[model samples]
Target: MNRLVTVAEMTLRELVRRRGVLLLLLLMPLTFWLIRRDSHVGQSVRALLLGISWAVSTAALFATSAARELEPRLRLAGYRPHHLYLGRMLGLWALGLAVSVPFFLLTVFDANNLRYAGIAVAMLCCVAVAAPLGMLIGALLPREMEGTLLLLTVVAVQMLLDPTSSAAKLMPFWSSREIASWAVDHTDDGYLSRGVLHAAVVTALMLVTVAGLFGVRLRRRRHLRHAPLV
Candidate 1:
């Protein structure tokens, strides 16, 4: 448990040290939020949520890719696979929440009569889903470019699709949109319920997938057995 916390803290330190990357990541969501600031409040907020999801997932992708070589060494040094991945996830989730805070505050000041709580829930869903989704891609695709392209494609499809379409529900960030609707449009509780359900299911699925992949990759092999000493 302490090891996990230590790994998470170190991961946070590493991200904080990359000042340029953190700034760029922060700029994206703010840009999206501000782009529609004058035209439509809902659009700006939804865009902001999308950008937040993208930023965190991209960070997760790069973080996982960067750690690929280092993880084996960490394993040799007595860390388990969960210690590495879960700790990294903890760091990424904290980073995601930090990135989200200002945008959330933006809604507080910039918009009126909004269900701010719903927006907060939507953002939570984004952070919950984005990290594992990105990690899964990073785990499956060895190259950063491949993982990035795949991530972009998913977000593109998500943007272009109609939210009511059955297909949009398949997108990982759909819950954010649904909950955003509840937040901005004053839709009934059904939207919030569906969004929460989707977020839960998707989060669980992605987590299981990531754990399975990590377990397989980090497992001990039979050939390296040690003989008992006399």
Candidate 2:
């Protein structure tokens, strides 16, 4: 418990110190809100919230602290890797939620509808979907540049083949049709059902991806540990 708490504190503080994370979490959302102020009220707010959530999750995964120092420092302090990873994941999720809530509230108030709750759920769904994807990318390509390029490629593909695109309809998270339909509906029934479905799918995918990444990391660590020393 103490180790997890320490890792969480350290992760949070490290996040605070990163200017890029700060800008992405704060300034970018504010800018989006200002720029889209004149647009359709509900849709604009939904888009802004989605963008902010996506950006924050992506940034958190990529903006890691110096891990080389981390292993030695933690070892010297007698901290376990599992504790550190758990704490870091907790901190990341907390930060993601912090950035998400304000935009959600803005959407709820501006839209002034119970359906806005669906929008909030959808945004969180997207974040859940994106975060593990980010972690998978991080694990596969540990180098920052490689991971970043991979992320950009994926983002590019997603943008080019959004839900409206025929190719994207097959993608789990990209199919925004249900959400879009519910967005047009004033009733909460379709909205809640579709939103919950999306959230469930995303949550499941995230869990699976996290498990895969953990397995890969564990295997690689074991291989390295057993390697003949020079």
How many clashes would you count in candidate 1? 0
Q: Against the unseen true structure, what C-alpha lDDT does each candidate score?
A: 0.92, 0.60
Q: Could you tell me which residue pairs clash in candidate 2?
A: none
Q: What is the lDDT of residue 125 in candidate 2?
A: 62
What TM-scores do the predictions have?
0.97, 0.72
lDDT of 2 by residue, 63-85 (tens): 44245345446645776556655
User: Lowest-lDDT window of 10 residues in candidate 2?
Assistant: 215-224
lDDT of 1 by residue, 71-159 (tens): 98898899999998899899999989988898889889989989999999999999999999989999999999999999999998998
